[model samples]
Target: MRILGVDPGSRITGYGVIELADTKPRYVASGCIRTRNDALEQRLAQIYAGLSELIGQHRPEVVAVERVFMSKNADSALKLGQARGAAIVCVANHGLAMEEYAPRQIKQAVTGQGGADKIQVQHMVTAVLGLNATPQEDAADALAAALTYAYSRSGLVAAGSVSSKRKSSSWRHFTP
Candidate 1:
C-alpha cells in the first residue's frame, strides 16, 4: 500500500509518500509545494495542479491529511482551510480513501508523546526514517502523517489476523 500524506498550508503545502509491503512501511519520497502570497487564487491553483501531478506520478492508494487546529489568526486558518479543501477534493474526486489526523495525534504517533515539540518531532522523524536531516519542518510533519497512518493500519491488520486465527483454532477445538 502506498500512502500519501499532506500537511496543508496556504504558503507551503508539504507532502510525503510511503509504501507498505509485508507489513513494513518505508519512506518513498517527500517534498513541499510553495506558492507566492501575492495572489490567493493563483496559489490555490498551483497547489491543485501540483497535487494532481504528484498523484499521477506516485499513484498513492490512500491519502492522509492533517486536520486544522485552533489558530489565532482567522485569515490564516481560512486560507489553510481552502488549501486543505483542495487536497480533499482532489483525493475524493480520484476515489481514493482519505484519513485525517489531528496535529497532536500526528505528533504523538511520531514522537510517542502528544505534547512533543516541533524540534522533537523533527528529530524523531529524521532518526526513524534515516532522513539526513528533517526535510523542512512542514515536510517533516507531512512525513509523520504518512508514517502515522502506516503504523496504525499495520497494527490493526496484525491484530485482526491474530484474532481471526485464534477464533478458527477455538472453533476447531470445540468441533472435535
Candidate 2:
C-alpha cells in the first residue's frame, strides 16, 4: 500500500510518499510545495493545485495529514488551519482514504518519544527509511506521519497505543 503524508503550511506545504511492502515502509518521494507571498486565497489555490498534481503523479492509496495544533498566535493558527483544510480538500477530491494524526502522535510513532524535536524526528526518519541524508524539517514531519500510519496499519504499533491521553481516529473515505 502507498501512503502520502502531508504537513500543510500557508507558505510551504511538505509532502512525503511511502509504500508498505509486507510490514516494511519504503520511501518513495518527499518534497515541499512552496507558495509565493501572495494573498491567502491565492496561496490556498496553489496548495490545492500542487497537491492535485502530486496525487496524480504518486497515485497513493491513502493520505495521512497532520492535524493543526493551536498556537500562541491566533492569526498564524488560523492560516495554518486554512492550509490544512486545503490539503484535506485536495485529498478528498481525489477520493482517497485519509487519516489524521497529531504532531505528538507522529513523533511518538517515528522516534519513540512524543516530545521529540524536529532534529530528532528528522534523524529517525532518515535512519528508518535508510535515506542518504536527512530530509527537510517539514518533509521529515510528513514522512513521519506516513510512517506512523504504516506502523499502525501493520500492527507494529497499535492504534491509539502511543498515549492514553489521546485517541486515534479511524481512516475515513471521502467522496468528491
Candidate 3:
C-alpha cells in the first residue's frame, strides 16, 4: 500500500511517500512544501494547494498526518493548526482516508523511543527505508509518520484484515 505522510507547518509543510510491501517499506518520495512569506491565509492556501497536487500525483491509499504539537508560542501553535487544517481539508476533499498520529507516537515507531530527537529520527528513518542519507528534518518527520502507520497496521494484517498484497478489508476504526 502507498502511504502519504504529512508534516504541516505555517512556513513549510513536509511530505513523504512510501510503499509498504511484505513487511518492508520502499521509499517513494519526500520533500518540503515551502510557502511564500505572505499573509497567513495565503500561506495556508499554498499548503492546501500543494498537498492537493501531491495527493493527485501520488494517489496514496492513506494519508497520515502528525497531530498538533502544542508550542510555547500560542501564535505559532495557531498557525500550525491552521496549516494542518488546510492540509487535512485538501486530503478529505480528495475522498481519501486519513489518520492522525501523535508526534511522539511517530517518533517512537521510527526510533524505538518517544523522546527521540530530530537527528535520531532522521537516522532511523534512513535506516528503516534504506535511504543513502538522512532526510531533512521535516521530511524525515513525514516519513516517520508514514512508517508509524505502516507498523501500526501490522496487527490488522495479522488479524486477517489484509491480504498478502496489503489489500484491505476496512478503512477506519482498526487501531494498533
TM-score of each: 0.85, 0.91, 0.87
Query: What digit string (tens of lDDT, one per residue) describes model 2 on residues 96-121?
Result: 88888889999988888888999999
lDDT of 1 by residue, 4-23 (tens): 99999888999998898866
State residue 6's C-alpha deviation in candidate 1, in Å: 0.1
Give me candidate 2's TM-score against the actual structure.
Answer: 0.91
Model 1 misplacement above 4 A: 156-176
Scanning candidate 2 in windows of ten residues, the lowest lDDT window is 163-172
RMSD of 2: 3.6
Q: Whole-model lDDT for model 3 versus the true structure?
A: 0.85
**Best of the two (2, 3) by lDDT:** 2
Best by TM-score: 2
lDDT of 2 at 6: 96
Ranking of candidates on TM-score, top first: 2, 3, 1
Candidate 1 vs 3: which has more lDDT: 3
lDDT of 2 at 116: 95
Which stretches of candidate 2 lie above 4 Å from their native place? 162-176
Better of 2 and 3 by TM-score: 2
